[model samples]
Target chain A: MQQKLTVSQLTKYIKQLFSYDNLLSNVCVTGEISNFKLHSSGHMYFTLKDEHSVIKCVMFKTYNRRLRFKPEDGLKVIIRGYVSIYEAGGSYQLYPEYMEPDGLGDLYLAFEQLKQKLEREGLFSAEYKKRIPFLPARIGVITSPTGAVIRDIMNVLFRRFPNVVLKIFPVMVQGEGAGKQISRALDMINKARAADVIILARGGGSLEELWPFNEEILARSIFKSEIPVISAVGHETDFSISDFVADLRAPTPSAAAELVVPEKDALKRHIMDARIRLKRALAGKIQREKQFLAQLSKSPSLRHPLDKINQLRIDLEQLNKRIENAMERKLESAASRFSVAFGKMDALNPLNVLSRGYSIARSSGKKIIKSVSDVKKDDMIEITITDGSLMCSVTDVMPGT
Target chain B: MDEVKSFEDAVNQLEKIVELLEKGDIPLEESLELFQKGVALSNYCARKLDETEKKIIKLIEENGELKEENFGQEAQ
Candidate 1:
């Protein structure tokens, strides 16, 4: 008969057997997680299961700290670790050294999870985005020092805008500690206020290679940057968390360079166009003013000022002729009336009778014998004529029948 | 003109000059003055665009102070 053993002894023997087996010592198992619990002591206990089977798993604080994503209940995952028997519980379980999400990979799941977390925190809100400068005087680039990513960006930037000042802040694009290195560069650039805009650029790579950009620290750093950030990571298809948090996102490194500054040739063309428009506008204004002046010069009052003066002169001559005619008529009528009055006075005068040769005789004693009745004898007589005065005495009057 | 502050300001002034001239209500002497100013502004803007050279620099920390290093034609 075989010797019997205590429960603890049997369990320890099984644990020893498990430690010696290479397959059980280091193995990868796929299952769904359930009954997950994280103790305050930083130990994680969960059960991973599939449609057909389940396994109890434990990831300690040390290994749990390295997990990129949180494992939840019902989550299918692939764990890499050793299978060992718990001597006290008398059961076997999986002690996972590494855990990853099944099918989708841990990095992608972490990216999605962080993206969701930041989205809820409003880090990707449109209101938080800063406006990119239309003409940035200085552009800061955060990328690898030696690679086509930097070369491509430099070529594009220099070819497009020659006047821009480019400041390169070299950092590791992908690898261990790349995320922290990138975050530090961002902080340095922001602290110095060295550039108007920043370009966080990297060449295309696998999801694993581009993991640094998906870090939460880097996302927050890019969001908190004072300068506007342009995220250009991987190819067009790859969308990292930095791309969502940045002010703008470019498809490629070359594209980011193109977005930072305007093309010199395009600006030159714009200036030329503006110059031509200015000249045309000025020329049109001058032509309009010239036309206005020409219109004023053609006014009737300005053209025929002498015609009005000549008409006034003709009216003055007509007034002078009317006054002269009236004066001459009045003078002739007054002279005729004065001559009539003089003739009437002259007819009443006795001088005309004297010139007609009528005379009167008187006696020598100056008495006139009129009737031949009683007459004194001696009387002196005088005679008067129109041309000479005649004295007659006692002239006899003859009574006309 | 030396009082002009920037290329954009110069361009803005030129546009204003053109607008004032376009109104055609100003005196002849004033219009001529504005035209002369606009011409000068245009010349200044063109010269600013033409005279610039490509510049590349690196940011470095030295003795706990941020400094710049001129990257010459080698970068090109």
Candidate 2:
């Protein structure tokens, strides 16, 4: 009798078997893709099918993040991953770690490989890119001399910038030695120090013809140039390695020429505009100053200087009157007080009492006699009246009765 | 600016002066100086744009040495 096993138990056993098998643990499979699904989680799920059978495959977000081309249904690709059993789903699937387009040409493959390698090396980083000059004094162009590319560039450059200086380095833009010649041209341009900026340009061509721009040597040269390089290789849609590494990328040679120099008339107009503004600003400033001076002149204080003086004078007179009034009031109160004191002192004055018919009698020795007992008969005596003292002899002494 | 060396510098300075004066807060002495400087810059820029003719020169590699020649009229 066969031993009974649960579904999970069977799947786990098969998963262990697949894990243990070396051949299943490492695999590289090539087949047409089917049922490709890119989940929102960035995981890629697909099926690989041959004419006879199909195998389920899944590429996790980690593996698929490095893929240059998006994997699609019915596309042929080679995937490298281990065939593993998912115990939860009770199925075995191919877990692809790497994937590449199967039948794409070698040129594209090489391009992709180089781009990925250089990107990993950080050569195409935006931080490494130099800024194109706002306006270049001299523009150095590297391209085939005989082609319309040169003429178009010259036309644009001369038409836009009437006083522009252009330095063109003629080079072969195609075939075997083109990349080396362009590289040498870049070095020569840099060494000469003649150009404010350089433009490496070519017309639209087949990928074979335009391959020189995509060459690593030219790319590295453009990246290494101290002077900013503007790349205009092939058509607008065609992107090359030099385009990525150059300081700026233009769609065409004409566009590069147009970009390198500012239009002479526009610059003239800008200067003229600023000049006019300067004039107007100075004039306006002067006008404002004049208006401000006029306003100041019209101000009450400045307009009639004597009005302020007169107002101050009036205020001074009012203050003087107030002080005089206060002083007079104080003096009058003091005089009244003096008059009252004088009256009281006059009442206490002995001269006033004596002038009122009272007399002070004294002996000749100047002693006062208050009663008859103070003097004897036949004694000389003196009497003090209002105005004078009189000496008399007392005939008889009289008592108070 | 200490000196106006190139058309770009001169124009930049002129524009700055214009902006400064346009604010109307600068003293008269400085405004007069800026106006004089701006006039000089404008004249220099105009002369620079007018006096120089358009020149297109070509670099010919002769015996591994590069030399310059006028290239616009003759595309060689």
Candidate 3:
């Protein structure tokens, strides 16, 4: 018998052997990269090597796509992965899900790494950035009270615009707990609604000194702020995570303050200019009205209506005088014609013929009969003349010879 | 940068005045009132700036008691 064993017993022994063999699994390693290659199929293969030891690593397509920066050989990296046996090769390797650049100052490396990460994520995009208010009423400042940063900001703000109200939420700007403290200050300011604009500032300092501003928590706080924030940490050259997440970035604390408040002098000058414009416009309007009044006064209807009425009155008077003269002449001519008719009638009157001695005598008056016929019979005569009436009795008869 | 209790109120009032004046339809009596209020707000803002002179005041926190440290010189 050759040590006959059951199948279960053999498998158990193999499993136990693999379990106790701590040569692989759950390791944190730091090393420089070597033999790094990116496959067209979207897989990453690299070797992590130290002075004496080396390990093979693989980052699948999904994980490789999330990397902030490209990985190259000779660049130091810190990796965390679980060691697993490759089923095909029957070898142990690292399947790293995350890696970070090494050898950079802890803060600087963290800053660059986070900045790159966020830039890829589009957190610092201009489309998401809010425009600063032209004239913020209240400004909140988070900084160390005793530092020159606050003093510089105050000086510049007062000099430029004397009206902006500044609320100081004093906090430790450096040291171990600065990040959490800053986050708390930001929360308090937001809850209080103490300001419309925020200035997160600190004076220039070394990488370690400015580390707290690069904190992820602070960065998130700045990103979530309802009020517009301006990060003015350190000098112009120094960049921090807070600068990326903030709505605006200023070179210095004083510059941040300048950004928040509009200059009073410039505003006053604008107002003065507007005032002048308004006055000029009003004057022009008044002048236009005056011209309008002048034109109205000169209108022919108003100026000459009375003259037309007077002229019409004179014409009426002339017509009345002509009518009166024509009426008088007509009456005189009518009277003269009546008088002439009266004279003509008088000329044809029998009394006028009688006055002209044209009457005839009758017998006498029959005594003057033609043959004097017979006076035998007593004759009575009646005679009529135009001037007077005479009565006579005719007692004789006329006889003709 | 001066620390004021009611900055928003002052600024809002100032803005209202500006708008009213710009509308150009204000009654003559109301214009005078608005002008007076504007002047008051302007003076208040100026005084706030003046109040923040350079006073080197120290914050003393001894035994958790916060006290002001006043510098000898008065800043003008």
Specify the highest-TM-score model's number.
2
Model 3 stretches with alpha carbons more than 4 Å out:
A1-53, A56-75, A78-109, A308-401, B1-76
lDDT of 2 by residue, B26-47 (tens): 9999999989988998999888
Lowest summed lDDT window (length 10), candidate 2 chain A? A105-114
Q: Estimate the TM-score of every prediction.
A: 0.70, 0.73, 0.52
Evaluation by DockQ, superior candidate among 1 and 3:
1
lDDT of 2 by residue, A321-347 (tens): 999999999999999999999999998
| Model 1 chain A: lowest-lDDT 10 consecutive positions | A371-380
TM match of model 1 to true structure: 0.70
Candidate 1 residue lDDT tens string, A1-401: 99999988888888999999999999999888999999999999998888887778889999999999988887888899999997777778999999999998888899888999999999999999998876678899988867788889998998887777888887889998999888878888898999999999999999889889999999989998999999999999999999999999999999999898878788777667667766776677778878988998899867888888888999888888888888988988988898898898777665675567655444555554354443433333555565665553444534446
Query: Which docking category, incorrect, acceptable, medium or high, applies to candidate 1?
Result: acceptable
Candidate by candidate, in order, the iRMS in Å equals 3.0, 2.2, 6.9
Answer with 1 or 2, whichever has the higher DockQ: 2
Higher-ranked by lDDT: 1 or 2: 2
Restricted to chain B, the TM-score per model reads: 0.76, 0.77, 0.67
